[model samples]
Target: MALIRFVLQSVVEILVLPVTILSYIGIWDPLYKRFFPYLMVKITSAINDKLGKIKKELFDKLPDFASSSGLSILEVGCGSGANFQYYPWGCKVICTDPNPNFERFLKKSIAQNEHVKIARFIVASGEDLSQVASGSVDAVVCTLVLCTVQDIDMVVKEALRVLRPGGAFFFIEHVVADKTTWLHFFQHVIQPAWRYFGDGCCVTRDTWKNLEKANFSELNLKHIIAPFKWSLISCHIIGYGIK
Candidate 1:
């Protein structure tokens, strides 16, 4: 079984190489934009069903805004707004992303998620969110975004800076697996190609460790194997912390 897994992984990598190259050249942007959301709806929905109570337990507890209206959430990388439906009721969301290709999907998501109001759509990278005021939002929600940022530290710092005291940073991101495992070795080997094709994603990134280094206390965090048919990049952590 292990040998078969290795063979399958190798075959998939070989097939994605050319596609990854095109992605690095900017040709894959529109294609990814068009397909990623659909893939996510299928993937994240299953994840929700499996994670049932866990998802609601955390999101329901997010800090409320000063106006008592709702939680003020600033989502970094807000990809196609895949997590929009899960947002708490009456939450005010500030969406930020570097990719202009996601604008249409985001607008559509905003329209669909009537519970969460769209406050603004900032065309900015996570590392530099100058348009968003510091110590303003009640929470910073980041899902599957830490892996792709050029500077994870800078981006995390900005998240901490913008969050009000006692605000939370909610995250769900895949991370590097056990160092001695076959999967870890495979990830290390294919990281360069993976990032190129995956829009700067690092499947081997120890994102939870990086998050620990940030200026916040850990509230809840644990790793779970992602429930995808293709599980190579499936090891992920889901949790949040107060700022």
Candidate 2:
């Protein structure tokens, strides 16, 4: 079975290489943008269903912002606004992503969640959020983002930079499996092809280490293996860090 899987993966990689090269060269951006949100919706819906309780608990840790205008949250890599359902009631969301293709999907999502407010959608990368001002938002949220960024540290720093004092950075990310495990071995072996096909996602990233080094005033994080049968990316870290 393993041999057959390897052969299939190799064949798919061969077929995908040309498009991957185009994607890297920026020539495929428009098509990729159009397709990625549709793909993510199908993928994340299953994930969100499985992780709903866990996500609710994580989002529960976010402190209530007692202002008449309501809480302000800046979500990095807010693809399709998948996490909008779990947000605090009446909170205002500022969405950011490198892909402009997701804005329509995000707006559609916001329309469904009537309690949530849309601040704006910024076409920006998490690693360089210069468009967002420093110490402006009450909190920053990231879901399944750290692994795909070009520089995880820079993204973490940028999140920190935009957060108000005592604000939180909430994250739920899949990280590298334990070094001695078969899953760990599989992650590294399949990473090159996976990164290209999966929109720069690296399964073997030490995302926890990056969060720890970000110097959040308070950090609470833990790992879990989601109930995914025969999945490469199951091990995940979910928690929040306070600035």
Candidate 3:
């Protein structure tokens, strides 16, 4: 019975492999973006609510040293600008993404937030944010973006270069799981196909390790599972750090 089940699964994966590859190459990303932005807002709003609760639970005792007044912030890979709503009032956020399609959405989203009127939207790649002056930003935010960038090291270096000394780098991302043997095996097997379908999102990169190797300080790590799953294979991770 197990052999038959395994064979069926393999066959299904093989059949979907080509579609996945093409999707990762961004063949369907436009279609996805059209419908995805609305759905993403709803879904991420819920996720952010939960994250708020979890953050309070985890860091309530820690000193809230981050500035509460207007501060210059940059968000790398701010897809559709969904996170703009989560920023504190009086923050001057600059949202940047390589995708030109995101510009319209980012502008609209920022317009809705009175406190975020100082926000700016830029169409730029993470690798070349050097166009923004160094040591000018008070904080840098990246969410679910590092996995898709062509060069993670360069992105981190650029983030470090732009951040002021003692400023924080905030991030929330899903990363490769490191738990059970079966989970690891499945991740290894599906990674190629997953990346092809998910726009270069690698499910096996240990982002925390990568950030540490980049020498970012005050690392804080946490893991959270997505609200839904199929056969324990679909889980998520969240990591944050400071510089």
Candidate 4:
């Protein structure tokens, strides 16, 4: 029974992986980005509570504000505000994404999490945060977004540019596996197709290393394995750095 089940599962994964890659990137990402809000709610429904805890951990690291409204959090690639419910009540949020299609999804999330205010929705890329002023925001939050940005260095610089002194950059992203292994080779082999299908997400990017180069005053991060089903994308890093 075990052998049969393993065979069946392997076949299913083989079929689903290819099609998922092609459709995700080539078919329609803008339209799919809109659907991602609902898809994510369903996909992460079982783990939402756990994810909330992780997000809260990062948010808590930010310095408490002296102002009435609390800290201004700039969420780069805020994709439908998936982390909105995790924020403290009354904290100000500035959600930004290059794709305008996600605006409708953001509205729904904002309505659901009314306590945390959605102060602004900027249609901007992570590399070019021209709409946001330098050293303005109290904290910057980015999750699962570093993989797909056009320029990781520019994006990190943009995040740093908007952060006030002593503020933190909270990030949670899947990174490249270790160099001395077959998994690392696998990641490199499928990366081109994966990048196309995953909307420019390079499964092999060493995002943690790039974060270190961003010149944060206090840098700290570590890796954690994801659930088994995402084995290929299982190497994840969740941590924050004070600027």
Q: Which predicted model would earn the best lDDT?
A: 2
RMSD of 3: 4.3
lDDT of 4 at 86: 78
In candidate 1, what are the lDDT values of residues 85-181, reduced to their tens digit? Answer: 7787778889999876678777887888898889988889999999999998988988879988998889989999998887888888889989878
Q: Write the per-residue lDDT of candidate 3 for residues 1-243, one digit (tens) a residue.
A: 447546655765787777767676877666655665565556556666656654444333222324545477888988766666666666777888877666666677777877664556777888889678897787787877887888888888899898877666776666666656566556666665565445556767767667778766777766666554442224455555667
Number of the candidate with higher lDDT, 3 or 4: 4
Model 1: number of backbone collisions: 0
> Model 4: per-residue lDDT, tens digit, 61-104?
65463134467889999877778877777778889998787788
Error at 87, model 1, angstroms = 1.1
Kindly report which residue pairs in candidate 4 clash with one another: none
Per-candidate RMSD vs. true structure?
A: 3.8, 3.2, 4.3, 5.7
Judging by lDDT, tell me the better candidate of 1 and 4.
1
In candidate 2, which residue pairs get closer than 3 Å at backbone N, Cα or C atoms, i.e. clash?
none
Listed in order, each prediction's TM-score against the native is 0.81, 0.90, 0.75, 0.80
Q: In candidate 4, how many Å is residue 75 off?
A: 0.3
- Model 1, global lDDT: 0.79
Please give, for residues 104-139, the per-residue lDDT of candidate 2 as tens digits: 888889889988888899999999999999989988
Candidate 3, poorest ten consecutive residues by summed lDDT: 56-65
Alpha-carbon error at 167 in model 3, in Å? 1.1
